[model samples]
Target: MKFGTMFTDILASFFKKNSTQLYPFEKNPTPERFRGNLYYDPAKCTGCCLCVKDCPSKAIELVTIDRAAKRFVLKYHMDRCVYCGQCALNCRFKCMGMSNKDWEHAALNKEEFLVYYGKEEDVREMLENISKPPAESEHK
Candidate 1:
């Protein structure tokens, strides 16, 4: 319409008080069924490859144990994940779930996105055994 009329309207609105939410002072609560993140249960996971197979985005990877071993190695790519919940839905173990904690999944490399599932002690012991510490010196 008229340039002068629009200009005056804009100026008036600029000085007027806002009647909306004060985001800085308020924290909105998440819903009960909010799908936030993905959770993987290593104990229930049978290495069935169901999650890996059904994932449309190919974000989930089924890293099985060594040829001789009968275990699994998880490598879930959170960065590429679309949170479709398809994998979690069809999982026989019911091992997966949408996490409520929403954290920014930022990483510089693809390897950083990989997630491993296992017991705390098992993982710690595995790392310790896999990566031995420096031997004691016998200097005279």
Candidate 2:
């Protein structure tokens, strides 16, 4: 290449604006179809377990509190989810879906990734059962 041509190119490049975004301070808007954090509505759930079956990653678990009473607890394993939106798509009652607003699931402990969605009393009871010692916990 000619010296004059190379010099001109360098001059033009120096005037170009930086093409970088200030992340952490500036958050880009999530797109309309963005598959993010998984959410569940226990009130809308019908204990069908359709969402659990459709999940390819097995990230979600449906715990039946009382099938006849329509009481259930959804255990969402965030770390295992692939954000494919499959569970939401297969749900006919609109009980499960991904939320664009709450996509941030950063955590240092693996336990934080396991989220429980259900009634206050039911969730408390389930948690108590899980925390019990192996000998005290029921086998079934």
Best by lDDT: 2
* Root-mean-square deviation of Cα positions for candidate 1 versus the true structure, in angstroms: 7.2
lDDT of each: 0.73, 0.88
Best by TM-score: 2
lDDT of 1: 0.73
Q: What TM-scores do the predictions have?
A: 0.60, 0.79
- Which tens-of-lDDT digit does each residue in 1-140 have in candidate 1? 89999999999999998868686486567776777677777777778898898999887776554324435555577777888889989998898888766645667888877665665554555556558977789995
Please count the clashing residue pairs in each candidate, in the order shown.
1, 0
Task: Write candidate 2's Cα lDDT for 35-78 as tens digits.
Answer: 89988889888888888888889999988888787788899999
